[model samples]
Target: ILAKFKSKGSLNLHLWTNCDRKSMSPTTFKSQLYTHTGERPFACILCDRKFIQANLLTVHLRMHKMEKLYLCSTCGMSFYSSGALWVPSCNHTGEWPHLCKFCGKKYITSGKLAGYLRCHTGERPYSRLCCDKSFHTKSALNIHMRTHTGEKPFKCKCHKAFSERSNMKVHLRSHDKS
Candidate 1:
């Protein structure tokens, strides 16, 4: 069945055939074990994404719903998941598995690894250029850009233009005030 699919040039499609077992290789069985154990050996530092296996991380994403099990006593910081706390703690303790190529910076979480890359690139976007002026952060830049672009992706029933959807909602109340 796998041969048939390969012959048809459908390698990208994950088709579960009724004729035979779904797994094509022994590697897949190993991945199944990792998935069951939630043992994500592969991690991303740029984003809060991880997978039990490297192959899974290619498609799998960070589950935002995971419980925040760890807490910081010093800073009173809380995370949405245990992985978030785990990585940061590991980084602070010099337990990082991956090292950055550009800089000597090391990170336990792939998300933080990517963020560190931004520091090397110097594109952290502390300020954004719009209409020959700079504004702090992309949100502010987006709002300022609207003034020059005259594009309102967000709209209210009152037919007023807004730089952001949240601003549009706030502006809508003004119509009722009058």
Candidate 2:
């Protein structure tokens, strides 16, 4: 796509596939490096940050000057630049494209899928065992082994593990309940 644009003698917008949207242009890329490194040839007395581009330096100076030009319509919150509004989140409603080959469950990220694969192979090694039964995952099998060993490694200074801390806390509370 970029090759086609270059061939047509239209060099205004280069289709930079790998660069960030604002950083696609060569001028912007160089300027961004200068901005990030605080090497502003045009320095503002109000703020210490420097920018290679005078216009960008002016905007940067406004920040130190506490000048807010971009305002949010929703809550009237102000921002120094329009660029401050963008935030990526895991709020997409699209179906997960990666399907687990073993269990057919879909996952949004590769890490979750990798963890799910361990369930199929039962490959996680145990540092401890419950009674004679072996299990995967140290945290899981440790909690189970505690019942037999009667050991509580997780403890508070008050000699109590909160309900969120360990299952032993819940089990200990159960004893009081009975």
Candidate 3:
């Protein structure tokens, strides 16, 4: 059937189906035809972005509208989607389900409990390739790497730069005195 479609001078059809000749439904064929014919019926009014499906356009419009429909009754926090509000709202009673076996400390998430376990086990998983120094967290090792690379990301109005934001704030104070 794909060979028949290809032989019928349907090169665009071959590209859309990715050479999959079998199991081509009428609805799938119609959608692929719309793609090749540049027929995007659903469009975002906020932006010029066009989508083939109405549901996709609806989801995209939420970003422009900034709709916070999902709300938490306890914390007074809002979320754009119901799924975003579900987890936090379920844990609203401030119950830490994940507990550390070593220290018996409770954590809201598994990732936080794993980080705490690393402290007791002396597990410094993140290591610097430049030096033999290791850190429990990737963020701590990243800050350490800036010292060796001398990469000053924080810059002042006077064209001077510092590796840390705290050091940059202190340098800005010197400018105020002058």
Candidate 4:
């Protein structure tokens, strides 16, 4: 199954057959089924995020609670999950595992490479249901959603809130000038 044909109404593909297990427990079978069927029964209480397993949902809830469970070895930055630490580690390791075929641009991860390719192809894959805005990456769409939710997570000591980190940084510059 190719990435481009994902939404093209299933190319009569039984590619999910590779994951089928006959001797596994019912719980294990259910998890494997959800991977192929896209069924997420475990939902977040705080946000729109859904998970196939309860433990993954628990890890996601930590994000809403601002729980720093994992710490970066290179930097003191904290994250709610161990998986989120990979992006920051790339800065310290200076490793480029993926490369773009269109351009000679180097990326830290395959996900970053996909985003760079989006820029080259001018494809806005992530879209907002609330508005007509579309974004090249899901992160950009997530940031745009803050505007509708009125969520200003980036806060300063003087009690100013900003939807975007760049906006908060600009505001902090004003504080330094005064």
Measured over all alpha carbons after superposition, the RMSD of each candidate to the real structure, in angstroms, is 14.8, 17.0, 13.6, 8.1
Give the alpha carbon lDDT tens digit for every residue of 120-139 in model 4: 99999788668999999978
Residue lDDT tens for model 1, 1-178: 2222332353332233423333545466446555344466787653434455664454333322344445866455666545456555664566877689896776676666766676577664534343456533445565676678676755555566666778877888888899
Give the RMSD in angstroms, all C-alphas superposed, for model 1: 14.8
- Name the candidate that leads on lDDT: 4
Which ranges of candidate 3 are over 4 A from the true structure? 1-73, 77-91, 151-178
In candidate 2, position 163 carries an lDDT of: 24
Model 4: per-residue Cα lDDT at residue 157: 76
lDDT tens digits, residue span 65-121, model 2: 679898766556777777653211121345575679987998766666776777899
The C-alpha stretches of model 4 lying farther than 4 A from their native spots are 1-81, 84-89, 174-178
Model 2 lDDT-worst window of ten = 1-10
Q: How do the residues 30-51 of candidate 3 rate in per-residue lDDT, one tens digit apiece?
A: 5555644558788777544567
TM-score against native, each model: 0.27, 0.32, 0.41, 0.54
Candidate 1 clashes: the total is 8
Better of 1 and 2 by lDDT: 2
Ranking by TM-score: 4, 3, 2, 1
Instruction: Rank the candidate models, highest lDDT first.
Output: 4, 3, 2, 1
